[model samples]
Target chain A: MTKAKVYHDGAVSGARRAVDAVMTVLLAALCIVWIYPVFLILINSLKAETAISTTSVFELPTAASFVGLGNYIYGITKLNFLSSFCYSLIITVTSVVLILLCCSMCGWYITRVPGIFSQAMYLLCVFSMVVPFQMVMFTLSKTADSLRLNTPFNIAIIYLGFGAGLAVFMFTGFMKSVPIAVEEAAMIDGCNALQIFFRIVFPILKPTMISTAILETMWVWNDYLLPTLVLDIKKYRTIPMAIQYFRGSYGKVEMGPMMACIMITVLPIIIMYLFCQKYIIEGVIAGAVKG
Target chain B: MEKAIKKYWPVFLLPTFAAFVIGFIWPFLWGIYLSFHKFVTVSKTTFVGLDNYFSVFSDPTFVSAFWFTAKFTIVSTILINVLAFALALMLTRGLKGTNVFRTVFFLPNLIGGIVLGYIWQILLNGILTNLGLPLLALDAKYGFWGLIILMCWQQIGYMMIIYIAGLQNVPGDLIEAASIDGATSMQTLFKVKLPMVMPSVTICTFLTLTNSFKLFDQNLSLTGGEPAKASQMLALNIYDTIFSRSGAQWKGIGQAKAVIFFLLVVAIALVQLYFTRRKEVQQ
Candidate 1:
């Protein structure tokens, strides 16, 4: 796959090796550039509020400038970080779980049963995926409020509604590719459709289930606009909403605590990526390819 | 099994369908209906004909927002795909730490847009200030370029990963045959590699196009369309029109804008789908 070969004669392998070496260094530098802003936030988070001024932004925290965990402490207390984290956690987990379970069942049913009803449902789900949130935001929030789905606990149903399209699409795509021979055997063995699905087909769906879960988690966790619109912000706040509130009220931003809040908001997702990167990447690929 | 399972529809399909009705179908139809009416609230809405759309079209900020979003989408999509493809080409080469490079590049994508926006704001504002230039929000041009830069950084890794997968699937034997036929690298890339990765191109371009058009969170946090809303994209423009204003007229206009935006997306998605299907037929 190396293009260096096409650039050189038969005896230029050493030159190609050097070219590869140089390219490696260039990529490494680009990687540093890629990761620099986050690193900058980390350093500035530890700096004293006074020392994190624009001129001194890139400088490492000196003894006089360092505040250790002070900004984190301030951010936790003032930004209301912990409760927001709890809210975000609840909303994301509940939404992802609900979407995966309901959509998987729905996906299985629609594919297995052939009818106009199934086809229409499938088309609607697919159509909803491309409709931008703006189209639905005004009425969605109003509907959620009226239905009392505006709370953190019940908002997952809304997530279920919004997320069903992609989940069902991916699920049905995989479901169609799975042969029905085993399912038929289970049917012959006196297993009802429910039993075979729960005991047999569900297990076969673990890979897709995992990927779907990851995609949903990444979305619902970091989502800002939906929760803000759907939930009564006075009563509930997700991490992104809280972050918006941190600097949202006034443009006279509080740099120190804002930095802490940014770090807090990003930390868990970064840790999760480090641990489950392969799954996350693959899941993203699956999600993207669905369109 | 199909016969038996069909009887159990209530157990499996009912819940999702119910939620889908409540969550998507109801809102979608209601949104479309609301777009044409002037409403302070749903109960207070009055049928306004095309009055809301008239307001939307006449508003200069909304008009500029459409053009700005169009320009931003075009520039960012081109830049992101080109750079991402280059990075994919580089990273796909057998090299030490390729995995590490790929990991680092892909990390920012997992982080939320609002967080990514603030991170860049801090860095960009700090640098601009140190250099005695206008901060990101202070000038529309700076805000424009700031968004361009941020979008590139955030999306390149994601598009690169897709492009890598595409490149990897381009069948090694074809490449070998090209080289054996005395084809240079550029020729191989344009004729063989590029044609083969058309699927990836289609997906990547589709994603980047729609995402760039539909962008909200990053644009909101990064610039908030400051300097008199000169930098607001269509999404943010719709948001501010509905949320920031105190009157029913703006809400109706916002809803109208949303409808227009939705139609635009559906049209583009359909066109892309048509091209992809045609390609599949040829292949």
Candidate 2:
């Protein structure tokens, strides 16, 4: 597969090597720039409050250096880490399952129905992707407060609505690539629509489901705005909201522990992304380029 | 059985339809209605005509935020696409270690906006602290640039993945044809490779535009319109109007701004789609 080298002259290989070296050096420099800030925060998080404030963030830690998880331990206690983690996990897991089920069903129906309405509804879902969360913030919050459904369950319901559009969009795209003959064969075997979806079609959508799960899990888990508005109670604070409150309540900035808290919240997202990145990219390409 | 299925279509669709109506449709309709009303709550809404829209236009802060957002969107979109396309091209050369490099670069995109914002804030603050300008005291220009950098870093990897997909699907025969016709490397890239990637380009551009405009969590966590709200984007401005500020007077104004924001987004997106879809080939 290698192309015949026009650059086979004596100086060509040398020049090519030089160019490659320069590109590698430049890319390495950019990588440092990209990744060093993260290192700065991680280092600062280990130091004492005074050390963080007084010394350069780049400074090496001395004998006083080994606070040895004190900052992290304290951050957990201060940020109400257990409560927030639980709350976030509950909301994220529950909402993702619900969104996946409902959006999959809805997507199935939309794709199956040969009507103008289904087409219009599909377009609506795509259009909703661009709707800013702020557009619905006030009315929805006020409506939630008025209906008195601002509890955790109600908040989950709200997430379903907010998530439905994107989920349906993804499901529909993936479903289109699914063969109709399979569905017809399942139908001929006396499979009801529900049975077909749950037993046959749904299993094929495992990858998209995972993609949706990862995407929504990250959004709902780390979501600040929606939870901030709805789950204002201390008992129900999600991790991001708790971190915000912790930051606000400290009055004076405590860089070490705050960064520690931030890292704790960020860890799950980074881990999930690292593992599911291939699926994420495929799902994004399928969902993104179509519309 | 077919008749039964036909009759039950509505039943199957009803749950999702109801939820969509209540959750998305209702709020959107109410937002449009509320934009013309004066009220703290939906129940208290009073028809105030286009007064809210009037105030939104006259507000200096809103104007500045609009311009700031537009400029930020333009710069970040360009930077993200260019960087992503370049990276995609480099990686698609079948080079060793490219997958590892792609994974490393794309890791940042997986982090949530709010977390990325706060992380970058600390890092930028560290650098700025040396220059004797805290993140807080830095001018709107600094905030603007900070956001652009953060957004570019997070988005470049995502756009790269898209461009990579686009590049992979570019038929080798097209490149071979160009080469056989005596096209130079740059000529092949511009005439053959670039044309083939137009679909990806369109999609990537639209994604960048919408994402930049609707940005909220990051804008909130990063600078939060620091240095006197000078860095406020349009979305942040609408949010602050509703929550940070008191009084029902501006609720309608916020809604009005949102409607305007919606129209702007839709119009631009439609135009972009039309332009890009025209360039897409059957293959």
Candidate 3:
């Protein structure tokens, strides 16, 4: 019986090892496939415009085809890539900060003060989440125009409104989990409502706040439709909008410069992601779980 | 405390309330009103009752777009969830370099939809050309599958993270008990592991369902509903109808389509939540 058991154990262990080896190889191959498309663009971004189209885009840039920063220069000077990048940065930062501050305060009030009005406000914010942007695109554009919200700086206000649903929802959900005694104790010590919120409650809500900030930043940064409709496109463009217009313009697309601009646009986000990857992953999971 | 908080309610809530009114509330109400009126612009309007809604039903393109979006959403949501769940299972097995792999997979999700669409457009076109097949723009089927692939690429990682969280929370004692009772690997997975991960499954499904339904940027930049608008999803269809159409009546018709689309999403989401929430086992 002992010998038979030993043989069976050996067989199972061998099979497990084989499965592990196969899975590792399979995952490695998939990783390559996932990364290849982006890599292809990066390499092609350096080639001369003539070579970009004449040869397969998969081919490496040769000595003859290498222009070396030529595309970057053209993208910045002619394609308005720099201005769009600056606009994207400004809008994302401003919108994220505004949403975080405004929604957190609103979320706290509604959660702490129980009443018909607060309940209705909370429900409305939740309801807004499911409403598709296309449902309001036309009227929204018109509204933005009338309100003079056609600039990047002012566009943050629009983001706050549209973003309030998710932000307030997440914030209130997190707030409910917080211990009420902490706030009450602070209040008893004579800290004003604003002081207690900013000095005490806000610190405890840091994780959720970070998560909210990251979520809003990602949305506002990558958002193409809202800004495209709300902003004066002639005067200001987000990175995605600029990329679309550049590719959509008449005649043959300057693939080299376009790819360069894409690289420039994607690099900063990737770097930020790498630095705070843990928080981003945590934030996404937290946000989804609450959502 | 209540009085203190109430006295400062204007400070606490007004910014968000004011913005929400401007951003969502007014636009939402205006959109519904516009659906009942004929207008070249917001200011130019004439009340037309149910005429615009009637025109939406008659537009074959809008109807076809609805069906197309439905099929795409079903396929992509299933693909993304299943693959993401499988990946989560594999990565949670104490594997080497799992974190690195997770990060790599999640990278695509960070890229914007428009950029994702254009990148996939070029790549798919290249591969299809090499394979002697029609480019993505030339064939509706290719666009459909291309969008699915792009969506899975972007979403699977996100869902995987959620699934991973769910998977890690599965009580180890339960798995050990099942194994000690001689439960097979397949049996443990199906009977034990899956039941515990249903919450993540619910969240992932809700996300994928809504996202695939509301997809616009990718649909626009990828194929732009080429080949006579065969592949246009509802959102893109509504956009084209509102903006690209010349007649003033098309705007209201598009608005009606938007209302219908909104209702369809809300109904589906509620039903999904109802069913999925029922299946979740309370810890």
lDDT per residue as tens, model 1, A17-77: 8888999999999999998999999999999888878878999999998999999999898
lDDT of each model, Cα atoms only? Answer: 0.90, 0.79, 0.90
Best by lDDT: 3
DockQ metric for all predictions: 0.71, 0.51, 0.58
Q: Identify the CAPRI category of the predicted complex in candidate 2.
A: medium
Question: Under the 3 Å rule for N, CA and C atoms, how many clashes does model 3 have?
Answer: 0
The A-chain TM-scores of all the candidates are 0.95, 0.89, 0.95
lDDT of 3 by residue, B157-228 (tens): 999999999999888777777777787879989998888889999999999999999999999999999879
Local accuracy of candidate 2 as per-residue lDDT tens digits, B1-283: 3443555676566766766776788888888999989988666778999999999999898999999999999999999999989988877765556777777777787677777888887777767878877564357888888999999989998899889999888887777777677776789888888888998999899999889988887888888888788999998999888777787687788889989988888887989889988987777
**DockQ agreement of candidate 1 with the native complex:** 0.71
**Recovered fraction of real interface contacts per model:** 0.81, 0.38, 0.68
- Residue B145 of model 2 has an lDDT of 86
Clashes of each: 0, 0, 0
Model 1, residue pairs in steric clash: none
TM-score for all models, in order of appearance: 0.97, 0.94, 0.97
Off by over 4 Å in 1: A2-10, B276-283
Q: Write the per-residue lDDT of candidate 2 for residues A182-261, one digit (tens) a residue.
A: 87887898888777778888899898887787677767876888887776665577777766675556478777788787
